[model samples]
Target chain A: MWRRRQDPDRAAPEAALGAILAAVLAILALIGPAPAWAAETAAAKEPAGAAPAEPMHVIVGYLGQEEVPRQPLSFLEPELQDEGVQGARLGIADTNTTGRFLNQRFDLVEAVIPRNTDPAVAIAAQMQALADKGVRLLVADLPAERLVQALDQPAAGGMLVLNARAPDDNLRNEACRPNLLHTIPSRRMLADALAQYLVWKRWTRWMLVAGRYPEDLAYAEALRRAARKFGAKIVEQKSWTFEEGNRRADSGHTTVQSLVPTMTQGADHDVLVVADERDIFGEYLPFRTAEPRLVAGTQGLVPTNWSRVHEQWGATQLHSRFEKLAGRWMTPRDHAAWVAVRAVGEAATRTRSADPEQLSRFITGPDFTLAAFKGQALSFRPWDGQLRQPVLLAGPRMLVSVSPQDGFLHRVTTLDTLGDDQSDSRCTRQ
Target chain B: MGRMRAGLAVALGVLTILPGGGAAAYSVYVSNERSNTVAVVDPETLTVSKTIPVGRRPRGITFSHDYKHLYVCVGDDDRVDVIDTASGTVVDSLPSGPDPELFVLHPQKPVLYIANEDDNMVTVVDTQTRRVLGEIQVGVEPEGMGISPDGTVLVNTSETTNMAHFIDTTSLQITDNVLVDSRPRVAQFTPDGRHVWVSSEIGGTVSVIDMQTRQVVHKIGFEVRGVPKEAIQAVGIELTADGSTAFVALGPSNRVAEVDQKTYAVRRYHLVGQRVWNLALSPDGKRLYTTNGVSNDVSVIDVAAGKVIKSLPVGDSPWGVAVKP
Candidate 1:
């Protein structure tokens, strides 16, 4: 269910202030003139020598779907408690910590649509309500299609939305919106991060195994492009046709043990790269591969936006704080949501404005820099509104490396090497 | 046997004479973050003379007012280890609140202001008594500490909060808070103390804040040809005694920007080791030292020539650098 007011205690003071203001205005009208009491009240509102501190209000809306129970293939990976919402909540709290000193207050409103409802219609209505409430900033955790629908809504015309979940590259390319900024790393970026590390390690030969899902194929396609860009060779490509078995079943291990070995029998490459975006059977292929090759891409040694094991560059503090708040490890989705909310906070703090247009301009401008605990400053690309950041290459227990590797340089920034650069961007947003 | 005894006497005489010699005998102390040790480097030879074991995760290092002790921030231990300069051993520990990453000592007073990154507060301690005096609430994740030359105002830069809080020394109250760019890592006041130079590690710029106006009067940016803009993260800043030139450590870019302080223009860039985080100037102001985190070495730069004269391998992940005159 949508938790309309995530924090009611925070809203009480503002509501009380509004009530007092209304009462004062009513009294002034009843007096019908600039009476002595009204004058005294006005003077009392202003301190003798100090100016009245008026806190700036910035409301950010979170749009996503109601959580549905997921049956994870492995018991080691439990269901997330709040996923994107918790990260947004943490972001709001972090912003408020800074906001207290800056005379600014950050608030987040949540709108979670049920699974049965049509997301497009529900999102349009939600956007209308948010717009009515003067909310111009949003963190959209929806898929690409629904996000586009939300963006196209007339109520959202003046809003600045941060895409926190969807990694669809088309959203940054052909379907790019001028008002939309993407915080999530695209598939190509993730693929290129892995490819660069593999190339640096001299593991240039890859055996690709793609699942049957379209998303899986899309990931495979991105990996192919990355391999070509980074001078890697895909020795062979095969599609996985085995049905996913229940991990809790008694015969599951037997099936996985035989299936994975046969599926990876022909690959004699340096690494076995799997593209199972749907999480069908990638986990089973890690240790049961035919050869003694290392596993990468989507599982095994993965390139991610965030990892629980990464502790370098002051990320240990972030990891501990998130664990304290969420009571669980921070996922990549949570990191994206945190980045999105921090972006708005950073923009408002720097530009000293609550206007959506001004904040948008500042975030896209050259002067804006976001310290996202990524060991570098992250900024959005003007052409596509994709936030440029270094991708972390991590194993299950430790951080292996960070990409946009040393030799992989770009004309603007090394971060531009991870994703679609400006010259390659097809986005026409002005 | 007589010749060998004569040689040993000559070596002992040379060692005694070196300590009495002027600035050439000064030692540069570097804190190795991962190795939990401090490497004492000889500036003249550009080599580590001795390695002293320290507390866990030693990051920021500074000398006491009298230069008798070196205070090192052991972030994991939540205390500052006081090292006796004469013996190069941990003599005592100061109860610096939680996760103290950086600290500054007042020029005239015996008070030490430590930035507790996890606590979001500045812990003030009496350097003489090693007792906690008070803690002033500041912005989140404070990582940088600086004090005015006159010791009237204390400045702390919070990395996540993105603000520099100015605290009045007498009252220990925050008088003003100025917003800087993202992740400001180091703050240093010029010799004259008219302006405070804050380096924003993630912002890739240096903000020079006027002391009187409490406003950023100038922001110095860097542009290295063939280097990515994001890689040019400005971290440590050091100004010469004459205030004519400033050296800035560009993190991950493997270079130090030499800027003309009067013109605020980058005069040249001296190549250094990987992921240079902090810098220290020699006693004579002729040699500048940079702690390279990734390369596990220190690069000694010649101030007049603006070149890295030599790179000496130190401990693992050397982060903070200080010089004992």
Candidate 2:
């Protein structure tokens, strides 16, 4: 230690300094092993982030190809299905580019089922093949029951099944499996988020329009639950069928008006919330509402995984990467698939190894977190497979606003208030 | 520079000034990179007192000029969180630029220079006001900044550009650009302020820059047969008072290389815990504290013998190390 003797109070070290040096060495020599009684677990120590190491492999398992045989009971048209699959492919490529730093490798593989055939068998076979190929993580964008049947294999213990397509609330809540994760927020979650936002905005009264389909009814039921939860009232309810389409011509506007009620119904609600999860007849209600009520569901105000018109703080980068890779923009389903893989990757980083049990625990742990394009950090629901995240509530042209505007005070953002939080959640058996 | 610990460890002197036995005197600080928690430990008793939680992603911690406050740059949280030495609580978060990764405090003033990795800027914050007094543009991902002994010149390490920007302290402008290895980080000056050793993680070596000449005098590579220079990924480097020896932590290889500062040669390559990222030597220069990132362990080495005496498990992805001993 040098003191240039420029300062008035400066002086050389006395004999006490020499004694300190001798004591310091003596302390270093008296070392001991760690007593393994830490306050926090090693895995949950850091904020959840994907590991820098590359994944073992990426397996994109399709159910089966149409070239095989006859078609299934229900599916979107071939062009629509192709569009969805195209969305998935682009998402895979986008993840690869974004995660290129970690040397994350990706592969897109597919299989198709025949007419009237059960998609479950083919999906299970593909999942088994995925296991053999050392892919312990998966992204399945299939329907509800079929996805469940596909993941029913006992050997699928190590594989993390991510539901990319299925939006059935049961998949995220009651029927949620150990390794099975859901990227698609449940319909209940979306409805709750929207209802919370509406309630916060003081749009308390609702003009409810229910659809004929089961999924539609389920969505309506979810909205009803939300209305009850958030002190909103459903003032009126209306149901319609796909009727008199060809009969109503341009010249017969009077006839169409007579059949569909041109005058005011007995509705005293502020918002006309349509619960048509399917694109059946609710598409016609937006511009056709008699009174000036806010149309939702199929049009106007809609809650989805991700929207194309979204151009927020970090959306452009994700959208650009997705388009450049797959040569097309990502769909809502594609975003779900991507989030699933990223979640698994983050779990691997936390646990430091690809043990399924450890990764599962790491994810469900209280500290498990993953940052998405939603501009906030989200964690998983320990009781269920649901990833409690902000639902992107949007309109046709632009995003009106994100929900959970009030009462949500996360370390990051208030949007986290939309989805199922720990207290109001019913997933106790997970 | 092990003996550099003897002179620059002003915090350890404060601890030794207390009336305590030999075993309970030294204080150990573990910088948890991800959790942003600094674990304070009593080295002799091996007892962790409290995990002082700070801002988001706290890394690169150092005591103040008078060794009163432990200044930690909370990276993602965009603040230089200050810890009150006596209470060890985060009393204040210094307003900083986005992603303040590493920092250097001026020895005589209240100015704290924070390296903003994202915006490629060096924000000079008035620590007392916790306000940004001045800012200057630097290269991409400015990871480290160092101040001269007299506090006249400031050297900023631009990680991507692999160069050190020497700034005139009073003017706060870049006066010189001294090019070093690829991914130059942790630009630390020698104890006597004669030379600056810039650690290049990917280059697998430390470049010694002569301050007076403002040029790299020599590039010292870690000598090993099977280990490539890239594998070394030398991150954090420290030196002794006489500038006789220096220790460089190789992140990829999980080892520390002790190099002869004058000869520009590695004296010994000591095996440490897994993925050693940073280091801190005891005040008496007898013990060395290392943050093993991957293994989440801290390797306490006997500096005189140059061997690991204890490997204490800390938090997940442990990174920075500061010793009060």
TM-score of each: 0.88, 0.49
Clashing pairs in 1: none
Clashes of 2: 14
Tens-digit per-residue lDDT, B1-325, candidate 2: 2433332322322323334335454577887977769998777645567789887778878787666788888877878888987798988778879878788889899889988876668999998877788998876567878888889989898754446778888988776666555567788888788888888765566777788777667777775443422246788887766667788898757789888877877778888888788888776666678889878888877666677767877787787777764
- Candidate that scores best on TM-score: 1
In candidate 1, stretches whose alpha carbon ends up further than 4 angstroms from where it belongs are A1-50, A118-121, B1-24
Ten residues in a row with the worst lDDT in model 2 chain B?
B6-15
- Model 2 lDDT per residue over A1-430, tens place: 1111224332222111011111212322324321221111111121113344435444544342343222221232222345345555654554443223233355655544444555566656666776676565567767787677776875465555667778887676667666666778888778877887787778999888787878878888888887886678988877755452432246754544454334326678788888765554454555456776777764568877788777652465567656765665577777887676566555543334344444444555554556456634455555466776667778767888765554434322233344555455565334
Which 10-residue window in model 1 chain B sums to the lowest lDDT? B1-10
lDDT of 2: 0.65
The prediction achieving the highest DockQ against the true structure is 1
